[model samples]
Target: MDIPFIDLDAQEKVIGKKLEGAVETVLQHKKFINGPEVSVFEESLAKFANVNNAITCGSGTDALLLPLMAIGVGEGDAVFVPSFTFVATAEVVSLLKATPFFVDVDMKTFNIDPEILRNAIIASKKMGLKPKVIIPVDLFGQPACYDQINEIAEEFSLNVISDAAQSFGAKQGGKPVGGLAHITSTSFFPSKPLGCYGDGGAILTDDKPLAENLMSLRAHGSGKNKYDNVRIGLNSRLDTIQAAILIEKINILKNEIEKRNLVAKKYSEEIDKKIQKPIINNGNYSAWAQYTIIYENRDQLSEYLKDKGIPTVIYYPKPLHLQSAYTVFPRYPKNLKVSEFLSSKVLSLPMHPYLSSAQQNFIISSINKYTKEK
Candidate 1:
C-alpha cells in the first residue's frame, strides 16, 4: 500500500455523505451563479472569522485582485509583499500595473519581516513610488506578525491585505487569520485547511464600505441591478455547488483543525532533534498546511523517502525574488538571503487532518533513519 500525501480520500470517507447531500441540494435548486447558498456560506464564513463581512469569489487570485481593484491600486503604487510566498501575493499587484516591491521574510516564521516591510516602504518613497498597500503572507499555515504590521501600516497610511490563502483556520493572539489584518483573503482550492471541492476563494473584512465595494467588484460592478455597471470589475462569483460544499466543510472546520494540530504535534515531538523543525511562535496556532523541515541534503532525503513509498515535497524550490519573471522587481536590503537560502534546504512532508499515527510513525522513522546514516 502507498502512503497518501494528503489523504483526501480519508477525509471524504468521514464527510462524504454530507458533501453529497450538499451538492444534491445545489443541483435541485439549479441556481449555479450568485445562488442562495453563496450568501449563506458567506455569512457562516464571516461568523467563523469573527468579521463583519465575507464575500465569495472565483479563486484565491481573484480574492486578492478584487480587493486591489476596490482600493484602486494602479501604476506608481507600490505593494509590499514577501518574496518567500506564492506568486499570487505579488501577481495581483503586477496585474493592476502596480509595482510589487518584494521584502525579505523572517528565517524563523517564513513570513514577511515587519521591520523589512517598514524599510521597503521608505525605500519605495525614496524611489518616487507611492507606498499603497502592505501584503503580509501567512506562510505554511502560520499567521504573520500582524500587530506589528498593522502598526507600521498605520504609521505609513497604507492598507494591509493579508494573503492568507494557506491559513484560513489559523489564529494569532486568540484572533483568527481572517480578522487579523485590515482585509484578509483565503483560498478553497481543495487543499487548504478548510477547502471546498474546486476552485473557490473569499475575502473578509470589518470595514463595511470596503466589503460592499468588494461585492460589487466581483460581479461586473453592478449597482441596484445586473445591467447597472457602477465600476470596472471582473466576473468572479463562486459557484453554488462549491458554496454548498463549503458550507458543510466549514461546519466541521474547527474539528478538522484540531485534528491537524494533533498530527503536527506528533511530528514535532518525534522527529529527530538534529533536523531543524518548524518554529510555531508563541500564541500562534497553525493550520499545519504542510509539515516542513530544513535539511541540508533535502533532495537526497526526498529521493530516499520516494524509494521507501513515502512521499515528500518541496513547497518552494525557488523563491520568487530569484525567479526570472521577478528579477526586475526591487527588494529591500538587496540580498533576500534568507528566502534564497530556504529554497534549497526546506522540504514539506505529508500533512492533513486525516493523517494517522501509524503513518506518521513510518514517516518519522524513515526520516530518522536517513539522517542517522548521513
Candidate 2:
C-alpha cells in the first residue's frame, strides 16, 4: 500500500463539482480582476473568521507584506518573529528594509515564547532600533500563546500581528485566530488547511482604517481609483479564479478541521514513546496542518518509512537565523537552543483530512516496528 503525504487529490474529489461551477461562473462573467465573486469570497471569509473585514491578496507572502506596508513598517523598524517558522514570516520584514529580530519558540507548542519575546524587544531597543511589530506564528496549525503574547505587546506598546498562515481553522480560548490580534494574516496556498486551487491569501482585522489601508495596498496603492495612486504599493490582488475556488472550499472547512483533529489525536495516542508527539494546549484547537513529531534520529526514521512506501517530510531543516539570507540578522535568547534543536529533530508524517484508518494503522505499526528494532 503506497501512502502519500497531504493528499490534495482526495480533497479535490470531494469539492471538484462545486469548484468547477465557481470557475465556470467567473469565466462566463469575464470579470477576471476584482470580480464580484472576489467580494463574495472576501465576505464569506470574514464571516467565517468572525472578523469585520477580510482583504484578499495574491499569495501568503503578499498577505504578510500588505500588513507591514499598511502599518508603515520601514527601514530601521524591528519586527520580532519566531526563528523556527518558514522564512516567509521573517522574509517580509527584511524585504521592507526592516530588521527581523528572530525569537526562539517554545519546545512543546512550536510557537513564539512570550518571555523570550519581551527580552527580544528590550534587546532591539538597546541596539537602537524601534520595536514595531510582533508577528507570532501559529506553527503546524496550532495557535500561538496569543493571550500572553498580546499582554506583553501591550505592556511594551508594540503592535501584534497573528501569523495564522497555518492555523486558519484553529481556535484559542473559544475564539478564532483571525481576530486574535490587531491584525491577522493567513495563506490560501493549495496545501494550507483552507486552500484555494492556486496561490491566494487574506488579511483579517477589526480596524476599519487598517482594513481600508490594506485594500489600497493590495492594488497599486489606489486611492479612490487605480488611476489615482496615493502611495507606493505592489500589484498584489488575489486572482478572481482562486477566490472562486476558495469560496467552495471554505464552506466545508469546519468538517475538514474536525477530521484533521481526530487524525492528530490518534497519532498522538499510538505513535512510539521515543517520538515526542505534538502538545496542543487545553482550550486550544489545532487545524493539524502537519502532524509533526520529534525524534532523535529523524533522518533514519524517515528513510525507514520511505522504504515501506510511506512518504514523509521535514517541515524545516534549518532555523531562519542560520539560513543564508538571514545570517546577518540578530537572534534572541542568544543560544537559540530550542529552534536549533527542533530543526534537527522534527519530521512530519503523512497528514490530511482524508487519511483513512487503515493507512493510519499502517503508519503506526511501521513506527512501532522501527522503534522496537532499534
Candidate 3:
C-alpha cells in the first residue's frame, strides 16, 4: 500500500459514524451558514482553549487578519514577525498597509528569536517607523517562547497576535496556545491538529470588546446586524457545514493530539543525530503537527528517502527575505544567518498519529542504511 504523509483516512475510520450523524443533522436542518452548529462549535472551542471568546472564520489567513482589522492596526505602523515562518504570518501585516519588520528565529525551535525581535524594534524606531503589533507563529505545532515574547511586547507596548495556525491543542507553560497572548489565531485546515473537512479557523481572546469587534469584522464589518455595514472588511465567515464537521472532530481532537505526541517521541528517541531533530522546549507540549528535521545534506537525504519508498517534504526551501514579493520593502536586513541555514537544511518526514510501529522502524532503518551507503 502507498504510504501517506498524513493518514486522514485512518482518523476518518475511527470517527466516521459520529461524524455521519452530525452531517445528517445539518442536512436535516438545511442550515449551511451561521447556523446552530457554528454556535455550538464556537462555544466548545472557547471552552477547550480556555478563552472567554472564540470567533470562527473562513480560513487561517482570516484568523490573523480579522484580529488586526478589529484592533485597528493600519498604515504608518509596523508589525514585527519572523521571516522564517509561512507567508501568511507576514502577509496579513502587509495586507493592512502596515510595514512588516522581519525578525530572525531560534534555530532549534524555528520560532522567533526574542533577541532579534528586540533588535528589530530598536532598528524600526531608529528608522522612524512606529511598531504597533507583534505576530509570532507557532510553527510546526510547538508554541513559541510566549513568556519571553509577551514580556517583550509588554515592555514595548506592542500588541501580540499569536499565529497558532499549526498549534491548536498545544500547550506552553501549562496554558493552551489560544488565549495566551492578547490575541491568538488557529487554523482548522484539513491537515491541522483540530481540522475540519474544509478550511476553517478561529480567533480566541479573553477581551470582550476585542471579541465584539472580531464578530463585526468577520461579517464585512457589519454593526449589530448583518445589513448595517460600518467599516471596510472582507467576507470571512466560517460555513456551517465545516463548523459542524469540526464539532464532530473536536470530540476526538485531544486523543489525536496525544497520539501525535507519541509518534514524535518515538522519532526523537530513535532517530540519530545524523538527522538533526526538532527541539521541544521546556514546559511546552507540541501537537506534533509536522515533525520537520534539518539534515546535513537535505537534497541528498530527500532523494535517499524517496528511493526507499519513503516520502519527504521541505517545510520551506526559501526565506521571506529571498521571496520576490517581499523584496520591495525598504531597509531589509542583510544577515539572517540562522534563517538562511535552515532554509537549506530543513526537510519534513512522513508523520501522523496513525503511523504504525512497522512503518516507523522501516523509516528509521531506511535512513540508517542510506546514510551508511552515502
Candidate 4:
C-alpha cells in the first residue's frame, strides 16, 4: 500500500459528526456571508490563544496584511523578517509599499536569529531607514525566539507580528504561540493542524482599537455598513461556512495536538542520525506541522523513497531570496548562506496527527534503508 503523506481522511473520520452538523447548519441558514458562525469561531479562537481579540480573514496572507494596515506599516517603514520563511511573511510588507529587511535564522529552531535581527536593525539605521516592525514566522509549527526578539523590539520600539501560520496550537513554556507577539496571524490551510474545510485565517491581538480596524479592513473598510468604505482595504472576510466548519474542529484541537506530538516524537526517535532530525526549543512544544529532515544528498534520498512507495516533499526547495519574485531585495548575512544551504537539503516527510503506527514504521524503514546504502 502507498504510504501517503498527511492523512487528512483519518481526521475527517474523527470529526465527521461535528463537521456534518456544521455543514447542515450553514445550509439551513444560507448565511454564506459574515454570519453567527463567524463570530462564534472568532470567540473560541481568541479564548484559546489567550488574546483579547481575534479577527477572521479570507486567507493567511490577508491576516498579515490586515494587521499591517491597522498599525500603519506603510512606505518609508521597514519590517524585519527572516529570508528563510514563506513569501507571505515578507509579501505583506511589500504590499503596503514598505520595505522588508530580510534577516538570518537560528540554525536550531529555523526561526529568525535575534542577534542577526538586532544587527540588521542597526545596519538599517545606518542606511537611514526606519525599522518599524518585526514579522518573525513560526516556521514549521515552531515559534521564533519571541522572548529575545520581543526584548529587542522593546528596546528598538518596534512592533512584533508573529506569523504563526504553521503554529497556531503550539506552545512555549506553557504559554501559547499566538499570544507571545504583539499581534499574531495564523492560517487554516486545510492541512494545518487547526484548519477549516476551506481557505481561512485569523489575526489575534490584545489591542482593541487595532482589532476594530482589522475587522473593518476585512470587509472592504466598511464602517457600520458593507459599502461605507471608510478607508482603503481589501475584501478579506472569512466565509461563514468555513468559520462554522472550523468551530467544530476546534473542539478536538487539544487531542489532535497530542497526537501530532506523538508522531513527531516517533519520527525523531526512529530516524537515523545520518538524516538530520528537527530540533525543538526546550521551552517550546511544536504543533509538529511538518516532520522535516536534512540530508547531504537530498535528490538521491528522494529517488530512493519514491522507489519504495513513500512520498516526500521539500518544504522550501529554494529560500525566498533565491526566488524570482524576491531576488531583488537586499538580504541579511549579505549572502544568506544558511537560507541557501537549507533550501537544497531540507525534506519534509509525512506529518499529520493521524499517521498510523504501521504506516510510520514503513516510512522509517524505507528512510533507514535509503540512508544506509553503500
Estimate the TM-score of every prediction: 0.99, 0.99, 0.97, 0.98
Model 3 per-residue lDDT tens digits across residues 1-374: 35688888998889888888888888999888888999999999999999999999999999999998887888878898888878988888889998888888899899999988888888889888898999999999999998999999999999999999999999988898887798999999998888888888999999999898888888888997889998888889889889888998888888888998998988888887677888999999998889998888879888878877789888888888778998655333557788888989998888888898899888878777777776
Candidate 4 residue-wise lDDT, 1-374, digit = tens: 58768887888898888888998999999988988999999999998999899999999998898888988888778899898888899888998998888888877788899999999999888777888999999989998899999999999999999999999999988988778999999999898888887899999999998888898888888997986889888889889989988998888898889998999999899988888999998999998888889898988888888888888999888888787877776667798778788888888998888888999998998888877873
RMSD of every candidate to native, in Å, equals: 0.8, 0.8, 1.3, 1.1
lDDT of 1 by residue, 1-374 (tens): 37888888998898899999989988898998888999999999999999999999999999999999999999999999999988889999999999999999999999999998899999999999999999999998999999999999999999999999999999998999899998999999998888888899999999999999998899899888899999999999899999999998898899999999999899999999888999999999998888899989999999999999898888788888888988998899799998988888999998988888888889999999999998
Q: Rate the local accuracy (lDDT) of all candidates.
A: 0.92, 0.92, 0.87, 0.88
Residue 48, candidate 2: how far off, in angstroms? 0.8
Which pairs of residues collide in model 1?
none
What TM-score does structure 2 among the candidates reach? 0.99
Candidates 1 and 3: which is better by lDDT? 1
Worst 10-residue lDDT window, candidate 2: 1-10
Q: How many backbone collisions does model 4 have? A: 0
- Span of 10 residues, lowest total lDDT, candidate 4: 324-333
- How many collisions between residues are there in candidate 3? 0
Q: What are the clash counts of all predictions, listed in order? A: 0, 0, 0, 0
TM-score of 1: 0.99
